[model samples]
Target chain A: MQERKRTEIATLGEFGLIKHLTEGIELKNESSKYGVGDDAAVLSYPDKQVLVTTDLLMEGVHFDLTYVPLKHLGYKAAIVNISDIYAMNGSPKQMIISVAVSKKFCIEDMEELYAGIQIACEEHNVDIVGGDTSSSLTGLAISITCIGEADKDKVVYRNGAKETDLICVSGDLGAAYMGLQLLEREKAVLRGEKEVQPDFSGKEYLLERQLKPEARKDIIEKLAQMNILPTSMMDISDGLSSELMHICTQSKVGCRVYEEHIPIDYQTAVMAEEFNMNLTTCALNGGEDYELLFTVPISEHEKIAEMEGVKMIGHITKQDLGCALITRDGQEFELKAQGWNALSEKNN
Target chain B: MQERKRTEIATLGEFGLIKHLTEGIELKNESSKYGVGDDAAVLSYPDKQVLVTTDLLMEGVHFDLTYVPLKHLGYKAAIVNISDIYAMNGSPKQMIISVAVSKKFCIEDMEELYAGIQIACEEHNVDIVGGDTSSSLTGLAISITCIGEADKDKVVYRNGAKETDLICVSGDLGAAYMGLQLLEREKAVLRGEKEVQPDFSGKEYLLERQLKPEARKDIIEKLAQMNILPTSMMDISDGLSSELMHICTQSKVGCRVYEEHIPIDYQTAVMAEEFNMNLTTCALNGGEDYELLFTVPISEHEKIAEMEGVKMIGHITKQDLGCALITRDGQEFELKAQGWNALSEKNN
Candidate 1:
């Protein structure tokens, strides 16, 4: 490994620090007319509807720095907001990031963070525009706002699902949650609270899933190419069941997803078993998957099922039936959202 | 005050809390196609250039709850971002707010904050399209992203100042800084560390300036009415001197401003004297004024001079001359940007 250079953030001041961090950023989106070095960024989306979304990630609450790398944290932060735009069936164009950090972070730390942000923007073909940098008294706080564009007719909303539509999800679930569990256990062992070394020999995929989740842009593109506009769509951030319930409530319908149809990675299942946890429960309610969950017309079911990386998990039903799940053993049960309740969790 | 009601935020959870706070919000902007209850808000500005800006406010850094009311803090937060749009010669259309609070804040506290945000949106004819709510482990964190629009030809940038342009500023300076000083003094006294009672008898304007600063939307309207477009523009958030240097550096020009002509309120001057601080320094370097600092073509000097709440304090000069402040006694001193250096200050 190369020796890392460190510079204290205080020496650069706010303006100097921002300039240093954003100096190399190049705008890739045509909509972006002006980027950093301005009080505000100028953009134009003359022929498309603009999609806007924001996400806030705070230290000690949303993430644990003890096991999470700063670069991966930054990458995940940007991906989270970009995922929202993709969930709307839009192409992300630009983003502004606001960060408040305490004295504990040095200039090199911010550079590493910005490097991850830059990589995400480059890979997603989005522009890093304007943002604010300040100091916090406690932990680091990151707030990202992403701007995207979509054709007026292509923009999808969560309230548009209809009865009989097919519920589909891109990518597997619960791997990220299992990855987090592994990291936590490893941390405990490192602190001498446990003696076992984490057996992560074949669990690289799980760690990647948790630390560097990507937005399902490919899924969006594939759906567009297939001429399939989802009746309703949202990104699975707060677990599959929670997101499914959101779609059901907004669309005024119910859904029945098959437990057998829930996709889970091999590593995730193995980790869940090793941890003595219910694999089905984790797949249903473990959040941070960053997968696309959508409902499409039943007519397109066969086409969607044939597509790569997509699973037709269920079908929308009448509102009276309520949201439910059909177990692999032919038993039906009502589904409950056990996603991260940030406020209540904090109180506890 | 009447008896206040209290509600625990945990009872509603994150999703319910967001829904409750935004329940009464009505979309007034034509560009806003969707609001809340979605992964992303949809907007369109087919014929206009869009302007985007973001600001992050952290507890104990940008503000102190000890003296700053939650309502006023929210109001000021919204105004600060809106001011950036107006600074770009655009009308704000929509905003997305992301707030993370600890368990210490209840639902009622959030409601008060949202009430202030609603009032600002209502008065400005802007829509609160979307936001994210979550829990923080420490203090409250707020990030507001504002989107606005303007004609392509009418949008202003800071890098357009011409040599010999007339530099103008709306309203007064240093008042916000004075207000902050007063608040700190009162806080110290309240802690019993200082015996003197705060002598804020007739300095209500200063207090208001610090607590509830308004964006200069009226000035933008007035400039439009008079058919005068600034050659360069930006809001005076980081005091006049700092913002002026930015304009000068970006425009590749220099400036000369008369220290005597810089606008300072009587209360601000009196308070500076009371604190034994230099009044001129406060006016030149104290930030958070939320006033517009702009430069118009020299041809419009007479028109701008006659306008209400505007003072022509200086003129742009060739780059060779450098930025300077000419004192009443005819002494010329190079201007320095003593804006809020958050990192260095925190380190100290």
Candidate 2:
């Protein structure tokens, strides 16, 4: 391997590093009045409602740096928050990122991370308004806050799902989780091995799903163009089952999702069969899909059914019915929030 | 001895813990249209400019939990960001907080931290808009984003200082730094001691200054009431010398601050003498003051001079003069940026 040049972060210090990283970052949004080089960034939203969402990603718990690149980590961190904004029927306008890294990281590592963040921002047309960088004692920690804008009447909340609303989900699930499993297995297989590359042929999609998941920005834009405003919506980061339960609990309405309707890619099904894992369970409980889960009025069911990349999986029910999943075998099973909980004993 | 009840955070899970901690949070600001329990918090800033600032505090780096209580840490974290908004001459209206913790922490610990954040929010009339909570691998990490509102023409930036501008700072400095020193010494003295209390009778002010520093909200209000708007402003979190240098550099100007005019509390002076540290150096370079450092036109000097707890320390000069500090004996020394660099070798 060729030796890569390494620059000590201390050579630039805190202020110098911030200046170097944020230099020439021009604001693209009209709402971004002023950015960086100040105590605070100034934004103007004269006629729109501002939406704010934040996420925190910690090392070891949220990610493992052994196989994950710093750039992808940065991209995922920004995408998660941006997804939340889109889930709210809003357009992300600006982002503020805060990162704390240990001494093990070099300036080039941070550059790669920033480059990834910049790519995500450019793709979404969101401006990098401001951020804070500091030293950590152990591993890297990232916290991102996304600011978005929407019309007052266009914003969707989880509590708006009414009875009989059609439940819809964009794209597919289980791929990201399967990708994680594949990476973990490969890491174990390659442990202590020398001069041998792990065979991941034909699993590129799974790896991409796990390493670089995209937010459902297109789905949101399509909904807007179709004049379909979701009664309730949220991004599926904590698995489909967990998010469905949140929507039900918040909306005071239960749901009935059909297992056959849950979309899963061909790769995900094959991987589940190979791993001997339940495909439906993986589709329901696998998290980090970044897909949009939403409910719309029944009157718009035909419109949503015809929308590409979207699946009509369920319908909202009265609260007394309770949330349930109708299995393919004509059995009804109550939905349990078996999603990955960050504070659960398993994570610890 | 009393035994404190400790409950594992895993018992409540991430969602449960967040709901429990933020159960009764009521939005007090009209700008906060919706808060918590959603994909994103909605804010309506119909006519005012929005200000955003963020900070990241890490364990064993930005703070020492060995001596600093979690509640104080939470309070200080919120206040630091709030101070940034005030530095821009804005009124903080909402805050988003994200915390990552390790298995060592319990649910009760999080409650204490939230309680501190609640208290600060209540004091400042800022609403707890939204946040993220997750588990960390090692120590606790906190990131807070404060959003504020300001009139379009009233917002201030660091680059607005012009030649002949009068530099002013609110209240005294170095007390927080002295408090940190006192806490460190006492921690060292009380290490491994059983049931022995550290003697901090007369130094209570310093401890409070360090552990529970308040943002200069009153100073901002006073300036507004006096009809004086700062040409340039920023909080003195990174020491007066460092922050002054930032303003001078950004504004393309130089400054001449008098060392004798720098404010210092009596307790700080006494502590510096006891520690055999330079008092002037502490006043100039000791950070975490949370005080407002601002500059106004020379014509507003008379109004600022009459303002209580506010000191006129210097005047802006032409860019070629360079930033300098005049001693009590009229000796001129170029100002140096000696503020704590989180990425420096000393920190590592």
Candidate 3:
């Protein structure tokens, strides 16, 4: 055994660790046409069209152990995995969870986690089939794998969007990210005041959005109901601009998001102004919204615009046009994606 | 944050840690009638048959870093996951892997792991669809979720074995366990001798079995080719006798295994004798062979017997009669399953 000085992981950044960890993955399975390099991995199953997506959430990195409930963590883990599945335009059917824990957590904590997981399962109507459990050397870490089914025709790829397609996003933005900010602020107060009640008034919606953000299964169902098939789709886990840039690079298309069209929850808007942060920047770059972002032919814009859950944000453009955000005054600035790049993202 | 004295997990044993971590799990998915409470979880998918399987291997726990080549570890991890699919009598088509690594492991080590994974994927014709990567606080922990397909009529359950059915196992018994024993002994010798090269003559097969185990996907295929579906089946990861006992318990049937009929390779037999360990104990309780153990009706027994890669060991009996092992001299002793209960079995 070789003994060496241990270096803190923070110094390497998340991307560096991912790069370091996945450095030697050689795809041996024919089904693995793509692995570890995209939003979701592709698999070719015999006689069936299938998609598999996975996400891992670690305590402290993904959530604050103090303010976030364990049950919510479980629910969020399942939702995020499903988010990837939804991004593929597939209906999720099953999930398997693997958890690693240390002594600090108790059976009660696991119960809460399961409670949230169960709630998500009931809401999504997916089965909780199996999972693995082990003790971690540190805090908690969870890996959830979601199985989804889609017809070969219905499955959408990140690269499928074409120039001139109408860009749309479901639900509102900035709420979840702002909620996280509020929760963190509350945690700071709770740390100082031994017996003070948290000021939760006026921030309930945003806080709930952050703590219990739901995947767009309803939007997925709604899209099906409307007989609308997006040319391309993705769930908003990273900020709006980041996901857009992904679409831009992958689809070989650019986009122009109108600033006025970006939806920000009222509380999120106020919070952003209170914090001296730009509302548009928070909407454009804040993450964990769990909303669906999709694109359709320009002909479908009026049809999609009337929908209850979706909002039109931009239009895809030619490659040379580049991705940009247009202000209410009509000034356009080049869009830079600030999505949580696992490579350099700082762990909270 | 609450600060506490650090406690070494080794003091708790594997079972204690699993119990501590899983105590709070709540199964909310209607399809998840069971989770973390059975050998394999049952999940009902909409418009599809139940998809199932598992996998998790920790470096220090399942493999030693020094002698275990990185390629073998990667390949072995894939096999173990694929083996779970085989145990369900399902055709594994895709898998997602999540890996946690410490900086101590280099990029070259990761490449070695992926190389092995690729080899297994090619051999199995499965896909390395997707996976996640992160830095570990300590040792490497690898987990894989394998997805497979099965016809409703062909799916096997551990609870389906019946009384009077023939008990069967594929390939040799105890070889992997014996191989592990041989490697441990060699490691011990090297640790003590310092300058001496470990002896390798007459130890090749056993060592290979330990370092590189195969998933019996071939056996599943061959069984299907012979049109012989097992009444029940599971992989031999926790030892042959224990798996048999599980089949007995789950199926509510007893079994009588013949010591003379248990397949033993020449290398395993010799090593048992050399180590002065009971060959019967090794074959009965040794685990990690990744072979299939199943049963067929007495009438179907002949059909299975004629197939290549199968050995009939015993017959399933009535539950009241109980499970037992018959000696070469006709002495019948009760068989108590000594499976590796990761949830409760102390490593010691």
Candidate 4:
């Protein structure tokens, strides 16, 4: 490996640093008429409804720098917002990222973070249009706002689901949550031993799910090709149970999800067993999966069943039925959202 | 005053708290088709271009709570972002506010902050659309993104100034910076003396300017009514001299601003004299005025002079001339940007 060069941010000042960081950025989206260096980014989206979503991630609260690489942190931050845009069945076109870092970070650290952000934008064909960078008193803080566009008639909302709509989910769940657990356990063990290495053999999938999850743009493209528009949709960041509750409450309906139909990767299942946890419980309530959970008309169930990476989990029901899960033994129980609640767990 | 009710944020959880805070937010912009309670906010500006800007405010680095009230902090945070939209000569339509607070804040504390934000939004005709709230490990963090719209041909940029164009400013300068100095002095004095109240009896204008600065939307509207499109425009958040340098550098031009032409309020001059500082220096380099700075063709000088609160202070010059200020004593001096560079000042 080559030696890396470092520069102090103070030398360039705020304006100079911003200019340096965004020097070679090329706007890929036609909608991005003007980007950095302007008072505000100028965009044009003719005849389309624009979608906007924002997410804020703080150090110590959202990630542990001891285990999370700055590049991965940057990538995950952008993807998280992009996933929200995708959840509305919109295509992300531009993003504005604001970051605040303490003196502990050098210019090289910011470069690595921006590199990761650029990679994610390039992969999604999105434009890095504008941002604000400042200094924090303690740790790094990142906030991303993604702008997307969709045809006015095709955008999906959480309140559009109807009774008898088939519930579907793309990809597997709980891997990211289990990956977080694995990293935490390793961090704890390494605290006592100087030379101990994390034992991550055969668990790259879980780690990837946690460190580098991608938004389900391919799934959305496939759905469009299949001529299926989800009645309602949302991304699963706060666990399946929690997101399901949001859709149900917004649509004024309930759902019946089958425990066996919930997809779980082998590594997640093995890790659950090692930790003496129920696989079904983790699949239902573990968060940070970044998977698409949506409801389609029951009449299109056959078409969805033929698609790859999508599973038919259950069906929507009237409000009186409540959100519940039918177990393998045919026992029905009300689902509780045990996802991370920042206010109740950390602030209060 | 009636006693206010207090509630713990933990009791309502994150979702419930978001609902409570945004309970009656009504979208008044035609571009805002959908707001809050969705994966993303939906907007449409079919025949116009959209402008977006973001700003981040971190505790300790940006504001000191000992002297800055939470309501004022929240209001300033929103105005700062809105100012950027006006700087682009666009009409702000919507904003998304994201805040991260520590355990020390109660539900009522958040209510106060939101009230300030709501007031700003209502006054500006901008709707609160979508945002994310999380818990921080330490002090408060606020990030606001403002979305605005303008006709593609009417949007002004900082690189359009031409030689001989008359530079103009809306309102006076240095009052906000002087106000900040006063507050800092009072905070230092009150640290050791328990009974000393800040003697702000005659300095109400300075305190209000510092605590509740407003974006110059009125200036933009008036300029439109006058049919005088500025060649280049930007808000004076980082002092007149610094922002002038930005315009000069970007437009490949230089400027000669007359010392006597710079506008300074009476309170600002008195405060500078009391502090043994040069009034001209404060007017040139003191920041956070939230005033509009623009240049118009020399032919429109008479019209600009007739407008209320408008002052012509300078004229654009060739790049070879360099950016300078002609003092009242018949001497010229180069301008330096002494604006707030948080990275160098606080973190370093």
Candidate 5:
């Protein structure tokens, strides 16, 4: 918490505000022919297949600003869309952002958000081509459309998995879900109190996982360097069980995931225990990990096992076999998709 | 309005609702490689330069649901994005839509919205590539991103206007603004009463202009057929005066527009008189026209004059003359940007 001077956004008009925020931005991608200050952004994807993905984050629905810093919110929002590009085995090139905010926000607040977005774009080598900024009647709303490029034959789809393909995932899961739980607890503790800071000494990893998660760009690069083309690929955003089901349904196949082999961080396990929840269930259905999940031919199993930060947790099965989880006790159970459903949540 | 069945959105869930809305939407453009049911939409533009643009429409700030039907809202949202592509001298090829809605909306309501989107896409020959749908805490929020393609040398930008270039606009101005005024007046009349329909006889054109606007695709096609290229172009979303200012400021040039030449429909003039508002002011500052305002070489003035649906209002001037409007009574006034400012409105 730092005391700073706030400048009203009304001081600068809409065009003036857009110009002020995007003034110093320079296009860094060759595909980006024209950046801001135009009716539409011009791009040139001469020989590559263009990829487009969009995400909308709404206040109180997708996020709670009470515990989420504005910078981290911006960072996470960009990461969410970028992750979708990588999920299709593409290199992100340009982004168009549109935001609507109430008068509660000032120019400085917007600067912080754009700073986070700039950091993410610079790191990923994506250009901020164009965006629209306007006033909203309620809290903040952000909608981002990310464009990427992939070779004609390199793009992967979820319907490519076949029987006997090995299922693998990069990095561990459930940490981000654990982080959210901890944040909610801390927010509740400080609800009616003033000057009493909540303790979060050893749970820093959880908070970082929730607030500032990064897209799995390195994993995409590593797979390319290893020359391993996945049969099917997607990023794990809505929990492993839900995404796996999508692959199974689309590919017309089934899978058997090993409960014992599911990746879980130590911090996530500790937090799940403290909350008296099942760690395995958390790993399977707790989402927002932004980890790459894919399947390759079983012949490449040895190479996949050798790759650092990746783990083989299952294998594709025939359509009649059904998707299941093989427990450590040798019992098999159907995997239910209990992932977070924003629409369904409204009914409750 | 006819009575229709409404299904609860929660029953279908997010993914199910998306699948239901986007089912049977085949890709219509050759550039659209893969669409819907994937992490990202895939497109290919081998020789054409790609154009991208986005717009965010927030409830209450952008539209009033009480007076606007869901179908018209969706249609306008799509057109607003598509118009930007046409403004760039490109043909729209693909679109990605993201919407956030409160629980008050039902599955049938979304279908009506998507039906309008489908009609717009089909008419433009653009493909509905992909979209994200989530629940909002309040009213509806829509964000649409349109992708288009044009020849390498044909893309137009606002900064390309040069000295002595003739300024022209497609269709009529101020009708849409007048339509909005009529809708608001009717809404106020019916505020506390039921079954008392506010009469809008002899004003159907204005109502249509505000509810459903079409981009000037015909003008672009006609220009191409005539082998004419505008030096600069942009769609009129934020009033003619404000958009003209952008062209002048970006091109580092000035212009003199004749008030007598400004195009106005007969209906708009009558409505202006009824509202007791200045007719020229309404024509100059009224926004959401969605018409193409552009500058072509003076050498082609003869061909332009022969062109139907286009009115030549003025010509670009040297940077020293400044942007001004010459009245019919032989008076000159520096044009001011009194366009609708959503951000400024928040302060009031």
Candidate 6:
């Protein structure tokens, strides 16, 4: 053996590291048509069509231990990752979980975490196919990748939203955000005056909306049953304004959402008022609700209106029209694209 | 609005958590035939073979910051993850990488990490498809699920090894472990006991092997050229013994390895002696070599020997015969299955 110099990883840029690592990888499976370069990796089983997507959840940034229950956290992790598949109009079939925990966690703790994961899997009827468990030096990390299948003709892409499409959202907006606000406030109250029991009694729905957000899997099924194909679909994670902006950008169109029509849950509305915050602000900028935000052809508007839990909020327009919001006061305003930039910001 | 009780994830085990989290998931696409319940999730793409495999690397367990360069670390992340797919006799197409970083780090440091990842991707000719990024309070984590493809007939699993199959390893073992020893030595010298400019000049190969190991993509290519289908295959990640055990367990057979046949690079051999450790132990238990450990039927032995960089280390036997190692000194010893357990202890 001869001595050779090795360069450190820091010397390479992010792009450089990825290039060097994946080079010379040859795909020999006829079933793996695409890998590693798209929004989702594409895999073809012998008898099925599937799109795969994965994401990682880090403690602190994605959730807080102070208020989040381990079970809810587990459930939320599954919903978030599965949402990506649903965004593509795919039926989620299975998921693979990987977790790294610190020694501070015991087997009992891990069991709790998996219980939440199992609950989500069962609700969705997906199996806990495979996973890797490792011990970390600090905190906890969870990575999940989900596979979903859709008919070739029914699968929708973020680019499919067209001008004149009706933009809709299942369930109300901003409830999750309001719930988070209340949680933060309660934490502050406990930390400061040590007075009041957080007064969460009246905020059950909003709190549940935040702690255990669902992926709107039912809505996806409903759409299929009604023979409706969304022009574009995405989960409302980073607030309505931000998600709406994403739809506009990805679809190369503009959107106009009516303020009065923007559905706000009753509990979220009450809580926002109690907190002395604008109801619209909470709805527009709150992230992590996991509700489905999608667009449909205008011809289906009447049909959608008759469906339960579905609300029509806006319409798509030509690119030059730009994204806007018609306020309750009859004032029109431009929609900003900024959401929670988790990386650049310190405080949420 | 009413306050609801917070659920603690610790109450649910990892399995329970997984179940809870996956509830209510609906599959909308016909393409998603399978998800979350098998060794690997299945995706169906037209006219393409399926890609698959997984790995999760935790901080502190896999590397020591005192010696590993960030660039090498990043590249190694991709290399290790992709090795799983390779072990399955599949061509890696792309990878989805998800990382959990602590708040102590900045974007610049992350970019440094990604730089190494980029370099690795380029070398492997893989695309930087999609991944998730988030922050942790401390310690960094990376989970990679690789998508790959192989002709149905060419794919190999651990269960395929049979009686009389020749067990082989590509390149060498124990070098990476020795490299770690040398680097630790140099690090100790630099930390204290002045004037000890360590004689690290001649130890570069071992260090690089430890720090920036490469996956056996070349051997995979060669196997295709020679039209060889391995009876069983796996990457030498947790050491040779551990991998062999996987094959033995899965194939329901035993193995017999000859001590004299195991290959050890010159530098690794010397380092093993200097450390007052048996060179054989290093070869058997030292990990992270990232080489291919595979089995072939006796009929293919001659053809395998003709290939470059392939070395036969052992042979498979009937289950009742059991796994054993015949030492060069004519001492026969029973082989036990043991290696680093990620959920328990990582010797590194």
Where does model 3 sit among the CAPRI classes?
Answer: incorrect
| C-alpha-based local distance difference test score of model 5 | 0.93
lDDT tens digits, residues B259-344, model 3?
A: 99999999999999999999999999998898889888899867876877789999988899899999999999999766554333
Candidate with best DockQ: 2
Winner on TM-score between 2 and 6 is: 2
Candidate 6 lDDT tens digits, A113-141: 77787778777765444466665677777
Query: What's the lDDT for residue A171 in model 5?
Result: 92
Clashing pairs in 5: none
Candidate 4, which CAPRI tier? medium
DockQ, candidate 4, vs. native dimer: 0.77
**Cand. 2 Cα-lDDT:** 0.93
Backbone steric clashes in candidate 1, count: 0
Error of 6 at B264 (Å): 0.7
Better of 3 and 6 by lDDT: 6
- Global Cα lDDT for candidate 4: 0.91
Q: Which residue pairs clash in candidate 3?
A: A15-A342, A15-A343, A24-B111, A28-B118, A71-A112, A71-A113, A110-B24, A111-B24
List, residue by residue over B201-318, the lDDT tens digit for candidate 4.
Answer: 8899999999999999899999999999999999988799999999999999999999999999999999999999999988888889999999999999889999999999999999
Query: What C-alpha RMSD does candidate 4 show over the true interface residues after superposing them?
Result: 1.4
Candidate 6 lDDT tens digits, B1-348: 455344433333222333343333333333234443211233555555565555667778767776776678888998886777777777676666666665554444555667787677767665544555655567677777776666756667778899999999999999998887788778877995655557777788998898888978899999989989998888887788877887897789999999999988998888888899989878987888989999998999889889989999989999998888899998878886444455434321
Ten residues in a row with the worst lDDT in model 5 chain A?
A339-348
For model 2, how big is the CA root-mean-square deviation?
0.9
Report the lDDT tens digits of candidate 5 across residue range B262-339.
Answer: 999999999999999999999999999999999999999999999999999999999999999999998999999988
Could you give candidate 2's per-residue lDDT for residues A99-133 as a string of tens digits?
A: 89888988999998888888899999999999778
Candidate 5 ranges with C-alpha deviation above 4 Å: A346-348, B1-3, B346-348
lDDT for B49 in candidate 1 is: 96
